[model samples]
Target: MQFRSIAMAIGMTALIGATLLAPVTAAEDVPPAPLPSQSLAPLVEKTAPSVVNIFAQKVIRNRSATRYLDGSAFWRLFRDTLLFGYGQDRFESSLGSGVIVAANGVVVTNYHVIEAASGILVALPGGQVYSARVLVSDQRTDLAVLQIEAGGAALPSIAFGDSDRLKAGDRVIAIGNPFGLGQTVTSGIVSATARTSFGVGDFRFFIQTDAAINPGNSGGALIAMDGTLVGINTAIFSTSGGSQGLGFAIPSNMARVMVDGAVKGQTLVRPWIGLSSRTVVPQIAELLGLSSLHGVLVTDVFKGGPADSAGLQPGDVILAIDEFPVDDPQALRYRIATRAAGSTVQLTLERDGEFHKIAVSLQLPPNEPARNESWMPNLSPLRGARVASLSPAFADEIGADSGISGVVVLEVRIGAGAYRLGLREGDIIRDIDGRPVRTVDDLLTFRTTPFKSSRITLERAGSVLTATRN
Candidate 1:
């Protein structure tokens, strides 16, 4: 998700360190090292002025405390600053970055940075912080647009580039505040293209670079050599606490779609077919009596969902969605999420050794988040249903109150212990093995410690009940 924690950062840095570029040779090996970047001066001078730093402050309605009773050195520091504020007591605060894209100070940044924000400010290179208003935010792509009243004053701005034409090895520059270092810049070559990390969003297309991006770099500009905004600096792929140089940016093309809609006060729609797919292997290809394994194999179709209503079924190989080829599962998702919600989708599917077309009308995700946030972790589990330990955000979705606790079921295998007991998705198990379960670790401990026939108690709406799986 949004990367954090020193230990997590350190691990990511170590992972990316192994992939860093080789060092330049001294003396005769090379006539002279290539310039730190080929013609970077002109690019920086053109775009740096438009890349602004975003400062947004908001109150998180129900945030969890950073400290537990453990009282470790880490918690003690958190206690001093967060809980007690060392004594004076301060309120909750969140910070991130942004970029200027219009002469009138129209700016863009991650939607998360401004969620529930009461105040937003845009900081120019000269340290002039201008008050800004959120025009709109698209949670699907995690992109938001804010406008600073430029009035008659001239503000620096950058033009968006054709992100579809981007190629690997293209030189890029990132400008933002890394760890609160104001207006810092880092340069690197594009590491990979069309990369997918579902962690960023359910639908995916990222511009990967080796630029040294950090926490405060969110919502910054990923500029190309021609001084165009190619992408929005977003997340990093790291295991260590610091940047080992693997950074990701949201392509300008996708960002443009949301920005255009936001400016018009229109919500983007997404079409859905209600099917889960898996990459087809050679074995599966042969089993399906297919000549190749290029298409996405439909593995599960939710009963009574759009796909089912449209006569789409499991074992159907999806070849295409509209014009874009369904070459990968992520492509299918990307195509749909980018479409207007409630629109009918024309899908090419191969079923019963015959290929044909079907149009399925899209439905809004049933459990869309309060801010229209995307999917939550699946809580269908073997141990009396599951909840995810990933984020505290989903705790309330499963009927969990403030003190509720447990490892959420990310997935539930059919015929498993919990499935056989009539437990379904969105069930929150408050107690396991007769002990109040608060985390995944607690459930795992009970799984091995002479525990059997668990007396599981769960909260489904206002009712609480027990189930047994011997």
Candidate 2:
């Protein structure tokens, strides 16, 4: 029976092959189909000139050879000692990619690419290298704009495309310097759009693609088939330090905002609506009598802010921004942030099972109740830390809860008391020795006051932590 079955399978395979090999007859009436271009050569030729390699060199300083042993008695003793020449400085270099956005030598790249670099070099095609200076660097968006002197000559640049129109399954190509290999191109479709929660930057909205974005691809161009820039390749999710088909890019719409700020010699201050919200889940949708799980639930609205002025109340469901559906809080924030300040945007909202439209003017976060920043004295427990009174504007800038009132740490010096005690920037000093620290003056009072068994209570990243020095 086994031999018979094997013979039957072989006969079936032979019959299928013979049938496939046979030529079609006139009765088939099949016509030839057209083929695609089968080449991205034209697109590459038009877009490759805008992509460039970036080299940044940062200076490293050490007080001692054993500077890694910071905060130790031995480190302090050997620090600044001539025997080891530990005070010498060293240079650390990194490589990345950039895209030319303007004909007048303006380039855009990731902020992390040139962060703290003493010098930066932009290498164009054909071995031409030019010194570049940072015009502006925005940490929140992780985007930076640089100006290069091109001897007053126009440089090739790629035009920005409408990233808002980009959808999943759209063909795209990534041009970058992957792993220091100069000027490589990889093609893939956009895996997803409006992706969030990857933790790449303050703005969580991202364009996810399966293109081979590896190290050095950051700041490179993600070009559409029309030879226009759609996004700036910024990050990759991989376990082996290489592209695993999971890559994220900053949409061109966001990059355009940075470029515009750079051209105007202005800082990139994103417009804020002065509200907090959460994504509407299934349970929320049912409770709110929604047809589907769409839009975000407004959790809080700052008094006298844009949302408040526009008659937005807590428990209101924001359905869309200017007709663009915002299914999550990140999408809503991104849409609002990309628009210029002072511009009015129409919002669609649902309240009491009824839909309504309201116009709200976008504005910069108000800096009311002034920061009144203060630096701690050497005798204070938070010595070498810059503390400021928390205001709604300041809180928004530092990504802290505006509802909380306290002194927030703006900066912490290395090897200082605050550094040794694990105090860091963004930490809100709730109290010192159970004394409420609501203002910078409240913290400054501790500099001259004497307290036994120092205990500090602070809030960092939404968690309350206590640090004590006994």
- Among the numbered candidates, top lDDT falls to 2
Off by over 4 Å in 2: 1-35, 65-87, 282-292, 374-387, 401-470
- lDDT, candidates in the order shown: 0.70, 0.87
Give per-model TM-scores: 0.60, 0.77
How does model 2 fare in lDDT? 0.87
Error of 2 at 125 (Å): 1.4
Q: Put down candidate 1 lDDT per residue, 153-175, tens digits, no spaces.
A: 88988888887678899888998
Candidate 1 has an lDDT of 0.70
Question: In model 2, what are the clashing residue pairs, if there are any?
Answer: none
Q: After superposition, how far is residue 69 of candidate 1 from its true place, in Å?
A: 20
lDDT of candidate 2 over 96-183, digit per residue (tens): 9999999998999999999999999999976889999999997878899999987887899999999999999999999999999899
* Clashes within 3 Å, all models in order: 20, 0
Give me the runs in candidate 1 sitting further than 4 Å from their true place. 1-37, 60-89, 138-140, 152-154, 271-276, 281-283, 299-314, 320-328, 339-470
